[model samples]
Each structure stands twice: as C-alpha cells, then as structure tokens.
Target: MTKILGISAFYHDSAAAIIIDGKIIAAAQEERFSRKKHDPKYPYNAIEFVLNFAKVKLSEIDHIVFFEKPFLKFERILETYVAMAPRGFLQFSKAMPSWLREKLFQKKMLFNLLKKNDINFNEISKISFSEHHLSHAASAFFPSPFEEAIVLTADGVGEWATTTVAVGKKNSLKIKKEIHFPHSLGLLYSAFTYYTGFKVNSGEYKLMGLAPYGDPKYIDLIQKNLIHIKDDGSFRLNQDYFNYTTGLSMTNKKFHNLFGQNPRDSKKDKITQFHMDIASSIQKVTEDIMIKICRSLRKEFNIPNLCLAGGVALNCVANGKILKEKIFENIWIQPAAGDAGGSLGAALAFWYLELNKDREVTNKDRMNGSYLGPSFGNEEIKNKLNNLGAKFEILEEDVLIEKTADDLSKGNAVGWFQGRMEFGPRALGGRSILGDPRSSIMQKNLNLKVKYRESFRPFAPSILRDNVNDWFELNEDSPYMLLVANIKKEKQKQMTEDEKKLFGIEKLNIKRSEIPAVTHVDYSARIQTVSSDTNKKYYDLIKKFKDKTNCPVIVNTSFNVRGEPIVNTPEDAFNCFMGTELDNLVIGNCYLIKKYQNPALKKDYTKNFELD
Candidate 1:
C-alpha cells in the first residue's frame, strides 16, 4: 500500500506522477490544467489531480520525491560561472536573483507550497530529491519491457551531468559514464533551433521538421567550427561560437560571422534556403552523434535492449536513425521523455532504487500506453455538449466507430477524444485530430485549415499494429509514437526529374507516397502502431477505417490548434471542434456533427492560443 508522489517543476514542463507499490497510478503535466504551454511553476494542479485520481491524500503518501537536487544544480551553475569568470558576469547576474530567492531554498519553498495544498507541514519532511539524469534513466528503464537494458539520457543540463549512460537490471540501475554540462547535444540542437529563427526548447522540433527541406550543406562547417566529435560520440563545443553559457542568446558574434548571417528574426524573416540548410546540418549532426553513441554502447555492453530519456530523446528523427542502425535490437523510450517525465522517473527511482523493491517487468510495458491523465464519462460529456447547445448524437462503441470511419473515408477530419488523456507531448489517438492519410490534399488541409500551422510541417500516422510492417519499414511495436521510419517502397510514388529539381519547399505539394499526409518530403513517417491491448477503442476505430478505405493509416495530429496544448477535457475538445474545420467530434460514445452544431458556438479558436 505504499503511495509515492513525484514532482518536477520550476524548470519547465512541470509535472507530477504518483506510483503505488511500484505501479504508476497517474501522471500529468501542469500545462494541461493551467492552459499554459510548458508551465514551469510548481505542479500544484497536476499534483492535486494525481492525488484525487489515485484517491489518496498527502498524508497517505509514504514518500515524496523531487526530480532533481537543486543544490547540486546550483553548485554546478556557480562553478561554471566562476570558471568562466569576468566572461559570464551578465548571465551570472541575470541568474543569481532567482537562484538566491527561490532555487537556493527550494526545499523550504516546496514545503510551503505543499502546506498551501493542505498537506501537513510534518508530512513534507518525507520528501527527497533524485539526481536529474537518474530520474531520466529511471523513467526510461523502470516502465520499459526489458528486465535488463542500457539506458541513455541526454539533455541541455541537469545538476552537473548533461548526458549519462546507465545500466538497468531488474530493480537496480548503475551509472556507467556521464558527460557534464557546457558539453551537451541537447543545447547544441537548441542553439541551432535558436539560430534558425525558432524558439528554443519549444522549437527544436520545428528545426527537426524543417530538416527534410534542405541539404546538409553545413555539416563540414559545423563539425570544424561549432562542435568537435570523437569516435566514441563524446564531444566538446567550441564555446567561442556560443553564448548560452554567458549571455541571453544562444549564439555569439563569432557564431554569426561563421554562419555568414546574424540570427534570423522570427517575426520578420522568411525561412530561407540558408536556414533550411542549417537545420538539415544540425539534424544530421544530431543523428550522427546518437548513432555513434548507440554504436558505442552496443559494442561496450552488447545489450540488446536500450532505453532512452531526457529532452533530446524526444527527437524522433534521431531515434529513427538509432533504430535504422540496429545498434540495439529493441529500444524503449519514455513517452514523456522531456522534463515532464522526470516526475515519473523520480517517483520510480525512490520506489525501486532507494527502497530496493523487487522489479516487475512486462513485455507490453508498465506505462499502460501512457494514458495516465484525466478522463470524462459519457454522462459528463453529454452534459457539457448539451449545455453548450451543441447539436450531437450518441451511439454505442461499435456504431460510433462505424460512423466515424465512414466519415473519415469521405475525407472528413474527425476530432477524436476518448478514454484518459495522454501524459506526454504526443496525442496517441487519445486526444487526436484525425483525417484520411491517403488524401493528397489531407496534409495541406489539416495544416492550413484544421491546425492552422505552417504548410511545410508534416503530420504523423497512426497505423494498426498488424498493418505497420506492411506499410512502414518498421516491424517492432511503436505504441508511443516516438519513432520515425520510412514508408515501404511499394507504397511510394516514383517522381520525375523535374519534380525532384523543385527547390526548397516547392517539393512539399508533390506527393511521394500513397499516404502523403503522413509521409515527409524524405519519405519518412513518424509511426504510431496502435494495439488493442493498450487502447481497444482507438484500435477498433482505426480497424473500422481500414476495413472501409483499405488504407491502414490515418493522419494523427494533436487535438488542438497549432500553439495550444492538447485538449484535456470534453469542454476543451468541444471548443476546438467548433472553432476548427473539423467535420465531427467524438468523445467517449458521443458523436457530434459540426454542421449540426450551433453556428454561434464557433468562435475564433485562432485567437484562443498564441502561436509558438
């Protein structure tokens, strides 16, 4: 009956996770409830939700774990500033106030925050802190299917380690090696994200998405000037070209001079050929480093199974490269690989690593498909829709699936909200906007009309587990939608030389595969293989769609407009449905046709969220 609560906050993607006797009870991010993207405040809302969901009070919790040791992190920051002295004064001064006022005494602040939530001040003394990378490692390996595996975590920075290699066997994990801060691949990628006119942290994916549009023309220049890599994947940055350690911006004047241009002003600049090339170059470097690291790990440990966490692990493109290289026979990644997942990891680290509990492993993973967030019953949904004066119909599961499949086959975009919400960045069919993947116009239509995002941005596909290998080059399970793979050659459309010569984004509209909506310009698709064991309802709906259209894949994007967090409740889904060009909304067993809904319910959803 041991109940443990894990918290990660103050550094972005704040979240809370609870585990009962080593079983993950619930986990969620603050942004979903607060409606703030990457909310870094204390995860009070998320913590409260998990407690209620698990039907436990704070006093019942035997342990509470914070994701990282704040003092250790502060020490690292202080030492780095001292080492860089005189040179890092501005950044040091800018960071000191927060460190001194809040982070330096984070334990006291945490206790007060908990007391405000009605937890007894005495109970707060049970809290402990886990090292940052250890949390990442625990999150990756604990819920993974493997009983033994090599775990790799890479991020911008933790207390001191930015990257760590650990081995997990049964309930225990041992750190093998670590690469400390100021030498980080995650920061390297983020720096390019900044240089390419995209927001750091949030915009790293945009850079990865933009890579397919250009050649890796800057790879040599990047290797020679920006980063130095050895054969084993460990590398150092030429700090002369970077400012993240000492200034507000990621790149310095030396970097700008080397790149032959200043940073692109996101507000005024068009994504030019140069920007795309830079994106491509960095992506290539990232993939190369990841592959090299996996190769090194494989040769060193020869472990068939590998698990990954940390922010960089969210790079599906690099993950895809690791899979393609076959350095590891199997890879299991935490769906919430970013800081949000640290909460879960921290809790698990306490349960197994600290308490010495026996490990329980599962071939299907212990994440329960990462559907560990809030859900609404049909009665609640019906009431919400009825109160909104929205026109709707209700059906049983089978009929709803049939109707939704029929609508999808007819080229209608469906907002699918079912069961518990997902706990990570991906929608995973739980809170997804779906469309016909085979439609040549589906990509553009979903991007411009539905998501209101850039046309160049690609969508992902959720394929039935049985049909995944038939359509994609991947044969393994990818239930979490964290891996990218090429569309099978049989489904690809041959292109003419003139079509191939189309420069930059001109090639976007040229369909390269039958499932053009999900296929990127490079013929790769971010693949999510849905299994009935994890989510029977979603699996059945896709199964029905496949039976109707004979296409095994569907365009699966998050159930929100471009910049908004994924819809967390029935109300959020209903509002998004009314505001977007979606044809239908399906929540639990309730189905609503947009045309029948009150026209007045349609407000400008675009104005609801600020674009990232």
Candidate 2:
C-alpha cells in the first residue's frame, strides 16, 4: 500500500495529513498545538501528531506533497509589485525580505524544516507539487461521494489562479476553466472585511456573521462604484477603489471617499446601520456570484453533485443559498475548507493522479466522517489522570454512555472525548463540548462563560442521524455540520410582536428552533447528525440521551475557548475544562468534575476565565 503525506505550511494554517492507500489516515492543523490562531509556521506539531496517529515512521512515507507552487507565486508577487511600483513603496519594501529569505526558496526551506523536526527520510526523493488551484480542486473532488462531480474552488490568489472549475471522474481530473490572479471573490470579500472594522483573513467570518444584522442598503452603490459585475456574475474589483492587489490597505482613498468613511478600527465598536448595510450588500453579492457559478458549472458538466473547497466554502450562508438554488442535487464541501485542508487534497491528488490508485465511491465517499486524528486509549487516560494526581472514576462501556447522556440532560456541558480527534475545523463529537438543547440559557452560558466568545456567534447541534429530518429541512445527514438548514416549521417557536421587531443580534433571544440554544436568529442551524455506523460510542450516548429526555439534539461546540484551536490532547482538554465553566470533561473512562479539579490546574486556567 502506498503511504502519502501532504504538508501545507509557510502560509496561513500550516497543516499535515497522511493518506494510506486511498483513505485518509490522519490530519491536523499546526494551530492546535502552537495555540496561535492561523499559525502559518512549520506544522511540526501537526506532522508529529499525524505520524503517531498512523503509527508510521518518516521512512515509511512513500511520498510527500506540498500545496501550491512557490516559484509561480513568487512570479506573481514580482509582477504585481512592478505594476504597482511607486504606489506601494512602503508595503513593497516590507514584503521583499520575507519573499527573498523564505518564500523565494520555499521548497528547500520546507525540506530542511522537515529534517529539523525529525522527518529526515530524504524528502527530495518523494516531494511533489500540485498547482495551487489544482490542490483545491483535488481537495473538493477526491473525498466526495460521487463517481464524477463538477468541482468549484475559489479563494485568494494561489500561484496565479484564484478560482477554477473542474470535473473529476475516477482517477482522472481536468480543469475546465480558471479565473487567474489579481481578480478574486475571496480578496473582494476580504476587502470589505478589512473596511468593516475587522481583520482581513481572520475576520471574514465575522463579516458574514455581522451581515444578518444589517439590511443591504449599499448593494446598488457597491455594484455601481466598488465592483463591476458581468452577466456571468464574475466581477472586477474597481482598481480605482481598492488597493489589496498591491497595497497594504484593502481599499484606496477613493473607496473611503465614496463610502463617506475611513476604515473602521479593529477594536472600535461603533457599528451603525451604514456598516451593517455594507456588510449585507457584500454578502448578497457573494451569494449571487456563487449561485451563478454553480449554475454555470452544472451547465458545463451536467453533473448532479458539486464539490466545493478553499477558504470560501466555509461560508455556510452561501452554501445554504446554493442548496436553495438546487443547481446540483448534492454538494460535498471540505470541512477544514481553508488552507489547512489543502494538505488532504494535495495528498489525495498524489495517490489518485500520480500513483494510479483505484478509488471507491460511496454515498459519502471515504472521508470516514472526517474523524482522522490522534486518539488515546484507556491506559493513556489512566496515566494522565494519575500523573495529574486528580480524582477520577472509570466506568464500563454502557455506564459511560448512560452517564454522559444523563449529565447532558441535566443541563451540564460535557466534553465528549472519544476515538480519533476530527481533522476538520468542526468538533464532530470526538473533541466536542456537548450540552442539552432544551435549555434556554445554554447558548448564553456557553458563549459567555464556557466559550468566552462573542455572544452573537451561534452554537451547532448534534442530533441522532435517524431523527434529523423530523426537526430539520435537510433530509440527508450533515456529519460535518457545514450545512445550515431551517429547523422544521412545526418545531419552530412563534415569536411575539416585540420579538418580530427585534432585528440583528437581539433576535438571538427568541426561540426559533425546538432546540433554541443551537438555533440562530433565522430559524436555521448548522447540524451534525451522529450515526452508529460512523461513531458508535458517540451515537449510543445520544441515543440513550434521547431515550431519557425525548430530545435527540444536543449543543455540540468544539472543545476550546474562543480564538483558540480545538483541544487535541488530554492535557489540552483538561486545561480547557479548568479555563472554562464546563461542568465536566470526559476523556476515555476518566471524568474530571469541575467542582473537584486540582487547585494547581485552576491556577493556570485563571488567565482567561469568564462566566455567563
């Protein structure tokens, strides 16, 4: 069997993944261990995790694939700088040193970093590069549950191409069309993200989250002045108004002049109707373009399923729109859906395209429920608890499941740590903080006390797979929690007149769903349904919970504090438990009750304590 290792680093969200044969073995992002949001440094921690997960030595790795072609990206940089020459002298000066010292010789630097990190199995013999967009496409297509799929990948410029359309069948894939660099939907959205008092790459989700609070009052102005849209839905950024292509700022003086404003400061909190309107307008425009692109892709390939990846696919709002449009019967999106997941795509491409391995197509292909990370066994858990000198109890298989379910029903936030931590951004029960859905105060409690995140950011729900259709509009299982569908109308709560008038984040208080804490203001929720076939332990817990409480759904958020990566190790989970107000943390058979945790643990966790 061929063993392929994919590495994406030196950019945002450096990550590593190992694929054995045609199935994914393990994948993890560097940020989890580094504790830096979007740590673009070497994925040494992530690489080690995946290697240990698969129990393979570096020598056993047959091939190592890196996402993006560094030389091509460097060429784009040089050309862009020359075109914008004197206009961005300061930005250009700052960009050059990093380019010359690191990015310019990315391949050699990558090989050396691997060696420094104990991966000294001669990378030169196995290393390969796929075009940036090709990696994105492969990421979308290879794991999808389709014999053939029309694939769409759009993101900030990679090498040169920013967006591309492709068709994948069996082991063969072909790019049908590409939108080259300097023109990107991602950069466009990022420009607005920068303008609206948010960090560019990091704050795109914040912008999307903020849009629902505002009306699309600036859409006409945005279309007429900021960007020019064609009949095909692809548009050009009015270069006169934006500077992101070659300047440090996302927008130019003309952009501020037109909008009658300056870029909002990151920490400033002067959000008004105008800012909200701008966010709404840009969001509408983005959804429109995505739908049009999907329609065109359907016309081009005549395929029923569409595969989406890149940073853009993380837009659940847009994903919902495409689902409503029904251009394709099904869509399989990458859960990581960012620069990190490119590692999986890159490795899969090597296995299928280069190694000529045959692939098997299922109703959901071979993602294995995206649960491909390191998992500790009973002995490891016992050792950790003993080392910490903490009190704990070991329960039998049935007792563990029943006890966890009982805790959830009693309104306790339980950290449900099980086999193989998930690779993608979503928690997916393995490394999940679960709570009862029926509690009206659960959302606020978790947001304010446990997660210490923005009160506006909503939590997701994990339901038993069988009962998903009973309460959600989605008929199929959403194991990845990427799709947001409306809660069943029968299950929706009727709003009062005052609640009807309540717009924006204030609307979050209304019970729009049967499980209010997991629902958003719009009566829609990101859903992940547990199935016995995928994760029997997690499923059985929920099954027992449902039998007792008559509610199959539970709040399932990733196990970590806000702005932190999900917990990857037992220590990380324990530390997170101490840091937050979670009632309990369950890893393997060991359960650490918050009321009984060590005072030494509580001392270190006091740094970011909050309670709702």
Candidate 3:
C-alpha cells in the first residue's frame, strides 16, 4: 500500500493527515492535542497521532508534503515590502529575521521536526510542497461526492493568491484564476472582526454570530470607501484604508476614520449597537460578493457542482445564501475548511494530481462525516476515569442512550463525548455539549454558565438528516454544521412590533422558534444533519430523543469553554465537565451526574483558558 503523510504548520491551526492508497486514514489538528487554541507550532503531536492511527512509521511513508511552498510565500513577503517600501519598514524588519532564520528554509526545518517522530526517518527527498490555494482547492474537490466541480477558495493571503478559482475533473485539478494578496475578501472580513474588538482568525465566527442582531446600515459607505466590486464579483480593496499588507494590525487609522471610531478595546468596551451594525454590514457585503462569484462561475463554467474551501468557506451564512440562491445544483464544503485542513488537501493533491492516479467518486463523499480524530474504547475510557478518581456508572448502549435522552428531555446540559473527535472547528455530536433545543433558557445558560462566552453567540442545531427539511427551510445534506437555514415558518414564534423595535442584545431574549436555543435572533439556525450511516451512536441518541419528546433536534455546541480547544480525550472531557456547569457527563457507555460527583472536583473553569 502506498502511504502519504501531509503537514501544515508554522501557520495557525497546524495539523497532520495520512492517506493510504488515496483513502484518508486519519487527520487531526495540533490544538486538540496541545490544548492550545490555534497552536501554530510544528504539529508534532498531531503527526504522531495520525501515524499511530494509520499504524505506519514515518519512514514507511512514500511521500511527505507540506501544505504551502515556503519559497513562494517568502517571495510574496519580499515583493509586498518592496512595493510598499519605506512606509512599512518597521513591520518588514520585524518579519525578516524569522523568515531568514526559519520560514525561508521550511523544508530543512521540517526535516528536523520529522526526525522527532521517528529517529530512522532520514530521507529528505520524500519532502515536497503544495501551493496554498491549490491545497485548499484539492481539499474541497477530491473527496467531494462530485465527479467534476468548479472550486472556489478564498482566504487571507496564501503565497500570493488570496482568492482562487480552480476547475477539477476526476484526478486533474487546475487553477483557472487568482486574485492576489492585499485584495482579499477574507482579510476584509477579518478587518471588521478586528475593528469590532474580536481576535482576528479565532473571533471571525463571533462576528458572524453577532451579525443578525443589527441592520446592515454601512454597506454603501463600505462599498464606496473600502472595496470596489464589479458585476462579476471581481473586486479590489482600496489599500489606503488598510494595514494588513505590511503591518501587524488588520486595519489603519483611515479605516477607523471611515467608520468614525477607533478599534474597540475588547477588554474594556461593551458590544454596543454600532458593533452589531458593523457586523451586519460586513456580513451582508461578504454574502453579496460570494453570491455574485457563485452566479458568475455557474454562468461561466456551466458546471452543476460547486466545491468551497479556505477560511471564508467556514462562513455558513454565505454558504447557505449560495445554496438558497440555487447557484449550484450540488455544493460540498471541506469540513475543516481552514489552514488545519490544508494538510489533508496537500496529501490528496499529491495522491491524485502528483501521482496521476485514477479517481473514484462516492455517493456519500469520503470524509466519513469528518469524524477523523482519535477515539477511545470503553475499557480505555473506564481506566482513564478510574485514574482520575471520577465517579461514574457504565451502562449498556441502550441504557446509556435512554438515560442521555431523558437528561435532555429534562432540560439538563449534557457533556456528550463519544467515538472519534471531529477534525474541524465544529463539534459534530462526537465531542459536543448537548441540550434540549426546546428549552428557552438553554442558550443563555450554556453561554454564560457553561461556555463562559458572550450571550449573543448562537448555538447550532443537530437534527436528524431525515427531519432537517421538516424543521428548517433547508432540504440538503449539512452533516458538517456548515449551513445556516431559517426554522420553518410554522415552528417560528412571530415577534410583536415592540419586540422588533428592540435593538442588539435586547432582541436576544425573545424566543423565535420551537427550538429556541439553536435558533438565532433572525430565526436562522446553523444546522448539522446527523445520519445513522455515518455516526450510528449519535444518530441513535437523537433517535431516542425524538422517541421521547417527538423532537429530533438538540442544541449542540463544542465540548469546551470559550477559548478552549475541543476535548480530545476522556481526561479532557472529565476536566471540562468538572470545570463547567454541565449537569451530566457521558463518555463511551459511562455516565456521571454533576451532583453525585466529588465537590472538590468542581473547578473554576471560567478563568481556565485565555479568551479566543
């Protein structure tokens, strides 16, 4: 069997993946293992996990690919500095030392790092590189259910390209167009993310979550001063109002002046109506740009299938809009659509494109529901729980599901850890905190007492695949929790005129739907369709929930506090359970209720991790 190993490191969300004969074996991110949010160090632990899971030594790997070519990235940095010379020397000087010492020679540094995994791994020639956008495109297309697709990838600058369009047919994928750095849609969203007092990469989702609370009042001003877009969705950023080209910050004083305020000091400032309005404006602009691009591409290529990747693809609202507009007959997005996914994309690109191998398409796509991380057997979980002095009872599969369903029906927040962990930013039932979606206070309690996050941030609904259409406006597969759709009008609770007049957070408390916890302020829900074919246990649990309450939906959020990476092991789950306000813990067939556990085990979890 031919084995390929892929690595994406030195950038945020470092990860590793292994493929055997072009079939993905295992994939995981460094943050999960390191317990650090967006860890950018070499994915030593992730690499080791994939290698171990695949049951192969690093030396046995036929080819090893890094996600992006360092030389090309270095060239872009140098060229960007030269073009903006004298004006950005401070940023240039600070960056050059690291580039010269480490990043410029990534292959050599990677070689040394690989040796830590296996001392016998000494073959340097096995190392290769894939372009960033190419990797993103490959990640979206290769494992997709489509045989041929128009691939669109947009993210912060990768080498030179910021936005790319690629065509993929069978085993062949080629880049057709590129909009290079300093003119990025991803950076534009991130600029708003920064200006709104949120962390850049980590906080973009928060900004997206806050968008529905306010009006998009600044779209005209944004279009006039910041970006110039054509009818075809091609656009350019007016860099005079930005600083990301050659500075540490994402926006400049001109950008602040255009908005009539300095960047909000996140530590001190409360999120006001202005922040919500700004979020709404940027989100609308982003949706418009993405829709325009999808429409233009569908017209230009006449392809029925569209595949999306990169950081921007994580914008579920935009994905939902593209779907709602019927721009493509079928759409598939990479579950791990950020830099972490680049590792798998790099490996797959080398397998299909580099090796010129034959392609095979599956009706259900080859991601295996994106549950590609580590899992523990019941015995292992029991042993770990015993070692931690945790109190628990092991039950039969039927009993466990029944008990958990009963807990949900009673409005208890349950820490549900089972099977393999998810590879993406989302917690797909596998590593999730679940609650009764019908509970009106579930969202507020989970955010403040459990997640220790902003109250306005929304939770997603994990609905049975068969029941998705009945409850939500969507009729498509959204197994990755990557599509937003409105709750069915019949299930929605209409707001009064006075309620509608309330602005920002004031509107958060009004229940909008039967599944109030998962529904957003605008009645939309980020939906994850659970299928028994992919995740039998999770599906079975939800089925039992449905049997009990006649509702197939549950509030599912990542199994961690805000700023913390999703739990990776039984120990991590236990610690988080003790730390948060979760009412019960379920791992494997084990169950532990909060009141029965040792009081000393309770933790001050709110201050456990730094805010994302």
Candidate 4:
C-alpha cells in the first residue's frame, strides 16, 4: 500500500490529510482540535488524528507533502518588499524577523516538527512541496464527478500566482495560464471586507451576507478607481489604492480617500447606509468579474464542466450567478475550497500528477460528502455527558429524529451533533445549529440570542434534496451549501410599493419568502440540499421536519457562538449548548433539554470566546 501524508501549516486554516493509494483516508483542520478559529500553528494534533484514523505511523508514510513551496513564497515577499523600496520599512522590519527565524528556513523547521512524531532526519528527507495553485486545481478537479473539466483558482497570493486556469482530462491535468500576484480578485474582495469594518480573511462572508440589504450604488465608482478590467476578465489593480503588497494593512490612504470615508470601527459605529452600499457595490463588482472570467474561459475551452476551488470560490453568490448565466453545463466546487483544503489537494496532487495514476469518476464526488473528520461513538458521548453531570435522555435513532424534529417545529434552537465533523469551514449537518425556517423571529433570535453575531448577516437553509426545486429556483445538487438560489416565485411574498421604497438595512425585517428565517432581504438563500447518500440521519431529520410542518427547509448555521470554532466533541457541543440560548443538545442518540439542565452549570459564554 502507498501512503501519503499532506500538511498545510504556518498559515490560516492549517490542516492535515492522509491518502492511501490515491484514496482519501482522513482530513481535518487543526482549529477543530485546538478550539481556535483559523489556528495557524503546526497541525500536530490534526496530523496525529489522521495517522491514528488511518492506522499508520509517520515512519510508514512513503511521502509527506507540504501544500506550498515555502522558498518560492518567501521569494515573492522579498521581491515585493524590494519593489516598494524605502516606503514600507516598518512593515518590512516587522515581517523580516518571522521570515528569518522561521519561514525562510521552513524545510529545517518542518524537519524539526516531524521529529516530534519520531521521524528522524533521514526519513524526513521524503518530504516534497507542491505549487500552491496546482494543489488548488487538483483539489477542485480530482474529486469532482467529472471526466474532464476546466479548473479555475483565485485566492489571496499563493507563492507568486494569485489566479490560475487549468484543464483536467481523465488522469492528467495541465495549467494553461496564470495571473501573478500584486493583482488578485481574492485580495480585492478582502480589501473591501476590511474597508467595510469587518475582519479580512474571516469577514468576507459577512460582507457577502450584508450585500442583500443595500443598493449597489458605488459600483461605477469602484470600477473607475480600484481595478482596470479588459474585455476578458483579466484585470489589473491600480496598486496605489491597495497596501497589501508591502504593508500590514490591506488598504492605504489612497483607498480611503477614493471611498470617501475612513474604515468603519465595527465596535463604535453602527452599520449605516454607506457601509451597506459599499458592501453591495463590491459584491456586484466581484460577481461581474467572476462572470466575465467564466464566460471567457468557456469560450476558450468550450468545456461542458467547470471546477472551482480557492477562497474566492466560497462566495456562493458568485457561484449562483455563474449558474444563472449558464457559463457551463455543470459546476462542481470543493466544499473546503479555502486554505484548509490545500492539505487534501496537496496529497491528491502528488498521487495523480507526480505518480501519474489512473483516474476514476463517480456519480457523486469522492469527498465522502466532506465529512472526513473525527467521529465519536455513543459510549464516548455518554461518558463525557456523565462526567459533566449533564441531564439527558438516550433514545433509538427513529425516536431521536422524531423528537428533535418536533422540538424544531415548536421553535427551539438545537445544537445537532452527529457522525464525523465536517472538514471545511461550513458545519454541514454534522455540527450545526438548526431551527424552524417558518418562524418569523427565528433568524433574529438565533443571531442575537444564540450566535451573538451581527443582525444584518443572513443564515443558510438546509432543504431536502428531492424538494429543493419546490422551494428554490435551483435544480442542481448543492450538498455543500456553496450556492445561492432565489426562492421560488410561487413561494415568495411580493412586497408592496411602500415596502419596495424602504432603503438600506431597513428592508432587513420585511419578510420575503415562506421560509423567512433563511431568506435574505433580496429573496435569495444560500442553500444546502441534503441527501441520504451522504448523511442519512440529517436527511431523515429534515424529512421528519417536513412531515410535521409541511416545509422541507430548516435554518442551519455552524454549531458555535461567534468567534468560536465549531464544536468537535460531545463536551464541546454540550458547552456550546449551555453557553448560548440553544434550547437542546443532541449527540448520537442522546438528547439534553436546556430546561432540565442544572442551573449551576449555566455560565456567561459570551466571555469565554474572543469576538472576531
């Protein structure tokens, strides 16, 4: 048997993955184990978990692959600093120590880290590095249910390439073209994310969620000042407006002047019409750029299928727009499209590209529905809950599903934990907080009471796969919740002329659909279509919910408070359940009702986690 271990670390979303003979055995992110959001430390815990899951030792692995070439990335940073010359000395000084002490000698540092696993210096020589974009392309194409497809990857600078185009045919994949760094769609979006008073890497989605509440009034101004686009989607950043190349901050004074305001201090200022308009304008610009690129690529390749990976691919709004425009016959995206997925992609790159192995396609992708993380058994869950002195009831699978669905129907927020945890940023059904979609106050209650997040951000809908079309305009399988679709017109509640005249975030409270909890102000929803093939338990729960309420959809959000990582164990789930306003906790076949829990166990969970 050929065993390969892949590691992506020292960056946000550090992770580890193991593959046996080109088949994925296990994959997980370090944050899930560390209880830190986007933990960048070496993924020792994640690596240990994967090795144990695969029943292998580090010494037995044939190849250990790092997701990106560290030297190449360091070179890009150095050259960028040189280009900026004397203007960014402070930034250069701050960055140089880390590069000199750690990143510049990544090979040595990595070897030292491997020593902790009892792999000696000689054995550590087996390590290999893959190009950043190649890893991303392989992640997108190899696991997809496609024989041949066009792959596009765009992200904040990876080594030197920020965007790349590749084609995958059977077992072989080839890169066709690339747009190098200092100009990137991902960075552009992240810059706006910062400018709009949100965190950069983690706050982009918040910006996307806030877009539907405002008008795209700044689109023309943005197109004129920040980016220059050709007839095709290829574009150049003016550079004068962006400070990411040489400074710690994403945007500069020039950018602030162009936007006509300084960045918002999220803690002090309320989200007004200006920030909402900026968010909407940037979202529209991003969609336009993505659509233009997909159109150009389709005309060039004439391929029927398109595969997408990288952080930007996480923008379901853009993905939905591409689907609406019919840029390709079919689109498949890596559920874990961000840097966390680079571990899996790196391993797949070595298996397919380096070893030149044969390829096999399945009707459903080979991601195991992205549920490739650690799982706990009923005995283990029972022991943890007992140790915590928690109140709970154990029931059969059918009874558990029925009771949980009934609780949801009566307007209870449930922390639903089952099977293996998800490998990506999304919680899927494995670690999710579910609520009834028909409740008009469900969204607001979940946001302020349960999640403690900004009220303007929207929640996603988890719907039965067979009934997806009846609720939303989308007919495609969106198992990963990476696509947004409009609510079916028949299901929508048309707004009156007075309601239509409401501006900015004022439209937020106006109900737009039957499933108002999951519907955005613009009548679109980020949809997850559940299937029995991937998660039978979750599918059954939604089915039971439908039987009770005649609505097949439920509000689904990650199972944690704001700034906390998704709960990984029964203990984490119980803690999160007790911390928030969640009414119940369900793990395996056991259910714990909040009202029955000991009052002494209740603590202020808001103080437990740092806000992002």
lDDT of each candidate versus the true structure: 0.92, 0.83, 0.95, 0.92
lDDT of 1: 0.92
Which pairs in model 2 have colliding backbones?
A: none
Best by lDDT: 3
Per-residue alpha-carbon lDDT of model 1 for 77-169, expressed as tens digits? 889898888898988998999999989898888888987666554665788999999999999999999999999999999999999999999
Q: Which candidate comes out best when scored by TM-score? A: 3
Residue 428, model 1, lDDT: 97
Q: After superposition, how far is residue 117 of candidate 4 from its true place, in Å?
A: 2.9
Off by over 4 Å in 4: 119-122
Candidate 2, after superposition: displacement of residue 283 in Å? 1.9
Residue-wise lDDT of candidate 2 within 1-612, one digit each (tens)?
788889988779899999998788888889888877788998999998888878888777889899888888889888888888877788888888998998888777877877765655675767788778888889889988888888899997788888888899988889988887688999989999988887777788778877877888888888888777776666677788888766778888989988899988756567666777788889999998899888877876789988898888888889977987788998888887888899988999998998888888877557788888778998998898778766778888898888888899899989878888887778998999999988888998998888887777788888998999998888876788888788898999989888889777777777776789987776778888789989998889889999999999989998888777788888788778877788987898877678887766674453543211
Candidate 1 global TM-score: 0.99
Better of 3 and 4 by TM-score: 3
Instruction: Report the Cα lDDT for residue 232, model 2.
Output: 64
Provide TM-scores for the models: 0.99, 0.95, 0.99, 0.99
Q: Measure candidate 3: CA RMSD.
A: 0.7
Question: Candidate 3, which segments miss by more than 4 Å at Cα?
Answer: none
Tell me the TM-score of model 4: 0.99
lDDT of 3 by residue, 1-612 (tens): 899998998979999999999999999999999999999999999999999999999999999999999999999989999999888899999999999999998889999999999999999999999999999999999999999999999998799999999999999999999999889999999999999999999899999999999899999999999999999998999999999877889999999999999999999999999999999999999999999999999999999999999999999999999999998999999999999999999999999999999999878799989989999999999999999889999999999999999999999999999999899899998999999999999999999999999999999999999999899999999999999999999999999999988988988899888999999999999999999999999999999999999999999999999999999999999999999889999999999999998999877876768988
Residue pairs whose backbone atoms clash in candidate 3: none
The regions of model 1 sitting more than 4 angstroms off are 119-121
